[model samples]
Target: MASSSGLLPSEPRTLPSTGFQVVDASETIEEETLPGYHLGKYYPVRLGEIFDKRYRVVGKLGYGTTSTVWLAHDSVESRYVALKLYVANLNNTRELKAYECLDEADEKDHPGKTLIRKLLGSFQVDSHSSNGSSSHLCLVHEPLGPSLKEILDLMPPYSFHLGFLRPVLRNILIAVDFLHARAGIIHSDLQIANFICDVRSSDKAMFAKFENAEFTQPTPRKIISEEHIIYTSRRMSLSKALPLLCDFGETRLFSEAGTPGEDIMPNVYKAPEVIMHMEWDYKVDVWNVAMVVWHSLTGRPLFNGRSADGKIQDDRIHMAEMVALMGPPPLRFLERSTRMTRALWNEDGNWKNVAPIPDITLEKLGADINGYDKEGFFLFFRRMLRWLPEDRPTCEELVYDPWLMRELGLGLGR
Candidate 1:
């Protein structure tokens, strides 16, 4: 399939119809590890490429900030899988180790694989057209559907009901709990994009149909951007499907109570402690899951830092928004925090930069969880959205929440 220049083949190459524009797979593309790689750029993978002589890339699935996921046919398992190829020296060793911890836990009592995406295997692949270039770290995972935000995009304005919202959101919290308690890892980047629709097929023909399913391919959907994408529609019952929590590049050990993380999470979903540089632990995950729940209910971001002019604002704006929705940080919280104190308050406990956060009650959040599901939703919501991390309910406690049980009717914790 060589073209006249002998680089790209003249034969037409198939591209994903996922809507995001991509370079022709046949174009002369440089690997990210190449000498002249640019920011916000990655090597465009071509179809029919083989990884470690086992998985052959056939279609494009999606793209993340640091990697690109391809639909590959697994010769070993005789099934379709996803190959997440990362940039060279991307510091993914820690993430792999975290997965190992999860695997070890799964081998014992907890079934972490059922909650998060299954890590099939990992291997390395040589770069394209780079003479003697280093191999890229490729993570092999089970195939999953579009992300939660993607499904939300497909819904009409506020079309998602509490019935769908409850189950899906609870499942995400369950996955987060797995990472925090069993795995002992902090999913520093917990957001809607990191959650994918959980679905799989074993039938060869059926799997093939799934491999070629027409859906919006996610590109340009930057993980940390202020905007949310609209998916328009989905081919399956997204609510009935589970959510697979993926991406662990920012993961870390769930430190002891007083130990702090240097940096973690995107600005919008970031916890006050994390943003303010205070001691944080698994509670950051708790804060993020609350934001995820709100987004699920409203199909709008719970907090955004961008200005009305579409310009990205500073982190102070995010803090302002949190204060607006959740009310001000507790005085004890203010006392313990240095960065936030200097940013928002003076020594006399007087407000400086922060505005008085107005009232945005739970009932106004959506349809109010409705007649049968109000208690469960509100109780869980109140417990999880606390200003103090210590005040927030642990994942274990949230599991038995009346709201999740009664509202979701999930029989999750019985």
Candidate 2:
């Protein structure tokens, strides 16, 4: 039942206890699922039984909920990495000690190195029989490309471009300011399917400009160091490039943290002060980088919801459909957001805790709110979707915004 080429059946399977393994409804299911296929959260890791010996696994290519990526081949740097494994259980020793103190603070105070996803070593195997052993941890990355939601499903859209979103938001604000000032950490899951890209400069710019195209194929290999085709040709040459916020498995560490009102994100990029319990910090990663730059300039999702067999919706009904498209939540942002006024819109202030509100508004989250000439991108999405994370803005004042220095004209002083 687990076969989208993730094989698993020769009898004797037994995974559950939450390691997941229940999607066998008699096979036949397809809808472009691969990049961490999913059932309960991935249950397949077989690149020829973990490719015998000194690192080689080369396959799984993506996953989360405490890690699982692969595309190995590094018999000591013969190159072709992107490992990421980690999820062996000891209940993830404080996220593997904050990913080994952000890889030793990127070998002591970065100057390049530490844009997250670059571990490159960890091993321990045994316990699938022949009497107990268990410790299978792993992480050895740097295989980029294919995930900007697979390059916005192979591009064909455009607008917004502060010179390619200022070098992908200056490499996600230098990896979130080196994980909040050199490894204090706080990623708490940034979106865009955890960004990655480079596949050898997307096949030398698709072999120097569309060589025999059909959306540039070319994968015969021999040097295409993944970055998922250089971030799918940087979102097909900047479709308002923004995504780069990566996955640090619900990250945290501004000194022994977590439980700053749970629901850590992905519940529609959480953060209404961690869904109304408040006490959060790193401004809940600047309101999840303003709801992933308003779903990369509105491909839509300033909040959405649909299920009831409408196919699994309800992330607080897409944050009450993004507070009815960015409007009602201000009563001075519900009295200075004590996690949205005493734990989410209750006590007769109703909103039935921000239900499925969106009938739609803000000229429908934009894309021509009064004929788009990009009016400072909806005033930088209303100053980064402010709902009182101390009135948002601050990734160094959204990297000096003046509409991002008059759309990259310069003057971008820190």
Give the candidate number with the greatest lDDT: 1
Tens digits of per-residue lDDT for model 1, 1-414: 211111222222364545654444343332332454543245435555667886766566665557777777766556667789886557578779878888776435544457788788898766544233445788988767778877877867643566766667667777778887777888878888888877633222333543344333433222211221211111333434667888887887865333554667876787878777778878888888887777767777677766657577556666776776667677888877776688787877656765544356666665533335555566677787777899998776787677667654555443
C-alpha RMSD of each candidate structure in angstroms: 8.4, 21.1
Q: Stretches of candidate 1 above 4 Å error?
A: 1-41, 106-112, 128-134, 200-206, 210-240, 256-261, 354-362, 365-376, 407-414
TM of each candidate vs. truth: 0.78, 0.30
Prediction 1 global C-alpha lDDT: 0.65
> In terms of TM-score, which candidate is strongest?
1
State how far residue 402 of model 2 sits from its true place (Å).
16
Q: Where does model 2 exceed 4 Å of error?
A: 1-71, 74-81, 90-124, 127-133, 137-142, 145-161, 166-188, 191-193, 200-260, 263-270, 278-286, 291-329, 332-375, 388-414
Candidate 2 per-residue lDDT, tens place, 262-372, comes to 767676677665665556777778777766655654444466466657677555665576677665576655664455465446655557754557566654556432222
- The deviation in Å at residue 210 for candidate 2 is 27
Lowest lDDT sum, 10 consecutive residues, model 1, at 224-233
